[model samples]
Target: MTKVVFITGASSGIGKAIAEYLVEKKYKVYGTSRNPDKVKDISFPLLALDVLNTESIKIAISTLIDREGRIDVLINNAGKGITGPIEDTPTEEMKSNFDTNFFGPIEVIKAVLPYMRKQKSGKIINVTSIAGYMGLPYRGIYSASKGALELITEAISMEVKSFGVDVVSVAPGDFSTNIAAGRYHTPVYENSAYKDSYAENLALMDEHVDHGEDPMVMAKAIHHIITSKKTKIHYKVGGFMEKFSVVLKRILPDRVYEKLLMNHYKL
Candidate 1:
């Protein structure tokens, strides 16, 4: 039997790459995005969906189920990054980040659980980030959202282990995508209270993103994880530096890790 996979945020970036890869591998794929029209002409089924809206999520899931008897994989990859100093970040923006990144995936999982549970086999892959493991300047809000996802994946993995459903998280480091182009940049004022502290670091971080890893690297990783006979709960994919960073975080103390990150970015 051919397996089916549903992916969110399939309009572009990692989601699009994964969808294309899966389709090439001969898996039936249903991808969702807010602007379905943008991807409707693609080779696969593109459904209109907004993870932040429960009704939209329900409708999209139903549409997929009506067409395909079962979904073998659900990729929760719809999310965005909101960067700025914590204090300067707008309260509404932070809430939006959580809505899309954290709750969005949860809602999708809830909607799909009954079907997956009945089947006794399914994989849930949540696209988190390296930020989930370590905090970085100007990324507090984004990190918070990804961190929540990590915990959710951990808890759900244990809860559904007996049912044969697997929950895993993919934490990729900075990948070359429109993420930086689409990033929500909160204005930083030189004369503001945080100016002296955040000004230089913010510029340095922005520069780093200007030259990040290629998005195809992350796409390949996603493909490997989903198609694997046995999948782990968490997979860290990136260049050598990203893998090294994860190792450093695990081995170093809190203060030591902080110093390393600061020095790496020349902050």
Candidate 2:
């Protein structure tokens, strides 16, 4: 029997790449997009899903289960980036960021856990970011959201171990994707005291993301995680420096690591 795979944010970028690759690998793939009509060009089934909407998630998952009978893999890849200084970004904006980036994935995971638990086998992969490990200057909210997801992934991995369910967080460093186009630029930045640095750093960050590695790199890492018999709780994928930075955070002193990030961002 073909293994059933479901992925979120499959309309474009990393999610799209992963869904496409898995289809090529001959896995029964079902992907989600908020606007299914918009993603009609994709090869696989693009179910309408707004991760922030509880009903939307439940319906999408139910639809998939009705067709496939079981979901072997669940990829929580739906996310959006929100950029601005911590002080300048509005509270509501931060909530929106967490709604999609953090709470969204949690809901999907909750919906799939029961199915996986009963089957005694499943793989859950959450796509996080390198910023989750360290609080970036202007992208604080985005980092916090990813950081929150990272911890959830870790905690759930332990909780679900007995059920034979594997939960992993895949932190991708700057990947060239359409994330910037969808990024929420808090208007508060225009009137804040940190406006200058915010603009400079935001622009620099966008440049780096635009020049980042191909989304296929991320897709490959996820494929490995799905197929491997024993996978780590966290996997970092990107350029060497990006992966090394995570290691530095673990071994370096707070001040030293802080200085390094500050210098790297030219802050």
Candidate 3:
């Protein structure tokens, strides 16, 4: 039987790339866009789903299950980017980011687990970030949200293992995506304590995204994970240094690792 794969946030970026790739590989692919009606020129089904809404998540999953009868794999790719100093960024904005990146994925996972458990097999891939492994300056909230999801992936995997529903996370480094455009950025205040550094880092972050690796790299990595017989708890796809930074964090002392990040950001 052909595998049925569902992806969230599939209107563009990594989600769209994975959906398109899987479609070419002969999988039944259903992807979600917040405004599916507005998205044109698509080859696969793009359903309307807003990650922040639980009802929307339930509807989208049920809709896919209705058509396919089974959802073999789910790519939890829906997320929001938040950037700014931790102090300056509104608490509401931080909460909103967590809603999309952390809580939202959890809800989606919750909806899928029962079906997957009944089927006795499933794969889940949560799209995380390299920055999530370490708190980056200016990108702290974004890092924290994704980082929380990354850890959650591990715990969920263990719980779902006996049921045959495998869960994992893909932490991509700097992928060239429209994320920067959509990012919620706290204003650079004229008299804020971290004004100059925050402003400079904001520009640098955008530049990194612009020069980041292609999203197709992530697409291919995910495809491999889906086809594999056994899955790991976490898989990271990005440039060497980006992946290495995670290792550095593990080996380096706290202050040393902090210094490295500060130096890189020129803080």
Candidate 4:
């Protein structure tokens, strides 16, 4: 039987690349986004989904199950980036980021678990980020969101292991996607407290994202992890620099790691 995959955030970037790649590999793919109209012309079936809304997630999954009988894979690739100092980031924006990046995947997984449990086999691939492992200077909100996702992936992997379902988290370093251009920047302190510090950190983060790796590298990694017979809890995709950075993070003391990051950002 041809495997069926459901991917969110499929209108563009890594999600779009994954949909195209899987379709070519003969998998029946259903791609979802908040704006179905933007993806209507795409070759595969496109559905309307907003991860923050539980009802929308339930409706999407129900529709797919009614038509396809089983969902073989779920790729929680929908997310957004929020950049600014923690003190200068608005509370609502931070909450929104978590809703989209952390709770959103949890909601989708909950919705699909019943179908996958009955089928007795399925894979869930969550698109986390290197920020999940190590916090960055300006991406306080985004990093916290991804870190929560990483913890959830770990707990869910153990919970679903005996049920013959697998959950894997893919943590890619900065990638060349419109995410940088599209990142949400909330200046909570226009002329008030923490303005200077927030501006400096935001500028540093923007510089780093502008020179990130290609998104296709991450897409290929996702494909490999999904098709592998055994699931790994975590996978990282990036250039040598990213690998080296992770290595330093592992070996150095917390203070040392902080200093290195500060130096890299010229803070």
Candidate 5:
């Protein structure tokens, strides 16, 4: 039987790229977007899903299962970006960021795990970020959320391994996507003490994104992970420097690594 793959936030960007790539590879692909109407001229079926809404998630998952009978792979790729000083960010806004980036994926995992466990085989990939390993300057909350998910993915991998389900976290550095269109900025940044630094660092962030690797690159990496017989617990998808930075963080002294990051971001 052809494998069934369900991906969230598949309307565009990395998620859409992954879904399309999998479909081209002959996997039965079902994608979910907050507004299905927005996904036009797509080759795969798009289901309406708002990850923040529990009912929406349930409906989307059930709709796919009803039609496909099984979901062999689940890609929790739906996430939003937020950038700002942590101190200047409001409590509610921080929670909202966690809701989308952290809680949303957790909920999806829960919804899919039961079916996966029943089959005694499945793969769950959480599309985290390189920023999760080392928090970014102006995007503290976004990093924190991804960091949290990374740990969750690690812990859950062991917890579900006995059931023959494999879970892994795929952290990608900057990718060429319109993520900025959905990015949120802290309201207090304009008047806060970090305003000037925030402005400069935000510009640097945008520049990195503008020149980031193509989404197709990460999509191909994800495909490799899905098809490989030997699975890794964590995968990093990005340019050489970006992937190497994660290595340097592991070996460099605290102050030394800190200096490198600070200099890279011009902090």
Candidate 6:
């Protein structure tokens, strides 16, 4: 049987790229968005799903299952970016980010596991970030959220492997997407302690994204992982230096690594 795939946050960016690429490969693909009716000209079915809402998630999953009778892959790609000094960013916003980035994916996975277990096969791909490997300045909460999901993917993979289900996270470096526009930012107030530095770093962040790698790179990487019989718990896709930073964090001393990040961010 040809595999059936479901992707979340497929309205744009990396998720859309993956959905489109998979369609070209002839897999039965279903994409999701908060408002599917607004997105047009897609090659696959785009359903309405809001990861933050449980009922919405349930409906989207069941709708696809009812129509196709199976869901072979679940790509948790719906996430929002957040940037600002930790002190300046609101605590509620931090929790909100976790609700979408961390809790939301787990909810979707919970809804899909039963079907995968019954069928004795499935794969989950989580779109994390290279930022998750370390807490970058002004992006600490985003890092923490994705980092938590990365570990959750490991635990889930171990628990479900015996049931013929696999879970993995793909952490990408800067990508040229509208993520900057979608992300929430704490205003850089002139009187605030981090005003000048935060303002400069925010500009740098946008510059990195403006020149970031293509979303197709992530799409191709996901395609390869989905097809590979053997897979690792964590798969990172990005420029050589971006990926190497993860390795350096593993080997470098704590303070030394901190210095590198601070220097890189010009903090």
Model 5 agreement with the true structure over 1-267: per-residue lDDT tens digits: 899999999999999899989999999999999899966878899999988999999999899889988889999999999988888878899999999999999999999999999899999999999999987788889999999999999999999999989999999999999998799976544568987888888888889899999999988999999998889888999989999998999999989999998888777
RMSD of each: 1.7, 1.1, 0.7, 1.7, 1.1, 0.7
TM-score for each model: 0.94, 0.97, 0.99, 0.94, 0.97, 0.99
**Candidate 3 residue runs with Cα over 4 Å from true position:** none
Consecutive 10-residue window with the lowest summed lDDT within model 4: 188-197
In candidate 6, what are the lDDT values of residues 1-267, reduced to their tens digit?
889999999989999999999999999999999999999878889999999999999999999999999999999999999999999899999999999999999999999999999999999999899998898999999999999999898889889999999899999999999999999998998889999999999999999999999999999999999999999889889899999999999999999999998999898
Per-residue error for 166 in candidate 4, Å, reads 0.6
lDDT by residue (tens digit), candidate 4, 15-123: 8888988888789999998988855557788889999999999999999998999999999999999887777678998899999999999999999998889989999
Q: 141 in model 3: Cα distance from truth in Å?
A: 0.8
Task: Tell me the spans in candidate 2 whose CA falls farther than 4 Å from its real position.
Answer: 188-191
Candidate 2 lDDT by residue in tens digits, 1-267 = 798999999999999999999899999999999998966678899999999899999999999999989999999999999988777778999999999999999999999999999999999999999989889888899999999999999999999999999999999999999999999887644568987877788789889988999999888888898889989998999999988998999999999999999998888
- In candidate 2, position 43 carries an lDDT of 82
Q: How close is candidate 5 to the true structure, as a TM-score?
A: 0.97
Which pairs of residues collide in model 6?
none
How well does candidate 2 score on lDDT at residue 80? 94
* Residue 177 CA displacement from its true place in model 5, Å: 0.2
- Model 6 score (lDDT): 0.94
* Candidate 4 wrongly placed segments (more than 4 Å): 188-197
lDDT (10s digit) by residue, model 1, range 191-259: 678675576766766666667777777778888887788888888887788778888888889898999
